[model samples]
Target: MAATAAGAFRRTPIERSDQRVAWDRTDQAFFAAGACHILAWVCRESYSDKTIEIVAVRLPGQPQVFHTYAAWDGWAFDHSGWNPEPQLLAVNADFEGQPLERLKITEGLAEFCQKHHHRTPDQYWHDPRPRARDYIGRYIPPWA
Candidate 1:
């Protein structure tokens, strides 16, 4: 399931091409940059039956989300791959060295994005459904 979810978030050459400027400007890989939340939302849709949550990493007390991923049963999955939740949480340092906070959003993607970004996912990044379908096809996860 994790492997499939990771694959679903992998950007194809053209999707990469769609955001050519952001791709060229960043050091982060595919979904690691601005699109991490969309990646998490797609992954959550893949494992819909589980108690998976979309987790956002942000500076403490800040409404802005710096990163996002999917978490289920102590494991976290992003485009980068899987990590134990604790290890994933260990990397949240800002330029000033303030420890960022982890926000677990269970209310769905619209709620998550609206709360963190003051906009819906489509307003923030490309709508995720097409990319998810492109990779996962009609294959539902085992639990589903």
Candidate 2:
């Protein structure tokens, strides 16, 4: 599944872990990766507002902020506004719904998320890096 918005496109229905018994282990991995302090798998009753919410703290003692990303059309993710940091990028990346592969931790938290959750860089997410920078990062292919 894919979503097209403002001429931009993205994929969906990403599986971070197996749906069965692996769910618990996968959740732990995601937490250990430091991508988020609390990752909740929520089910919305309305299609008009169904989404996955990921709450995290950028650093210890920092205020906790709620980041909501859509998990429809076969993908999951949210935009980081304009700030581009590794931690924010990692949190958004996790919602991308794709497995973490070949993704490096330019930011400590993103790297932690990738390693602990076993995600690929090619996975979809609203990357804060510029187009050229995003490509150069090799976290995901620009053309992809």
Candidate 1 Cα lDDT to native = 0.59
Query: What tens-digit string does per-residue lDDT give for candidate 1 at 49-109?
Result: 7777888777788877777788878877765466666766664352326677787777766
Q: In model 2, which range of ten residues has the least summed lDDT? A: 3-12
Q: Compared with the true structure, what per-residue lDDT tens digits does model 2 show for residues 22-107?
A: 22233223323312222212111122254423323222333323232223333333232222234334544456433222221233
- The TM-scores of all predictions, comma-separated, are 0.64, 0.18
Instruction: Name model 1 segments beyond 4 Å from true.
Output: 1-20, 23-28, 94-96, 118-128, 132-144
Cα displacement (Å) at residue 116, model 1: 2.1
140 in model 2: Cα distance from truth in Å? 18
Question: Please, what is the whole-model Cα lDDT of each candidate in the order they appear?
Answer: 0.59, 0.29
Model 1, position 65: C-alpha lDDT score: 71
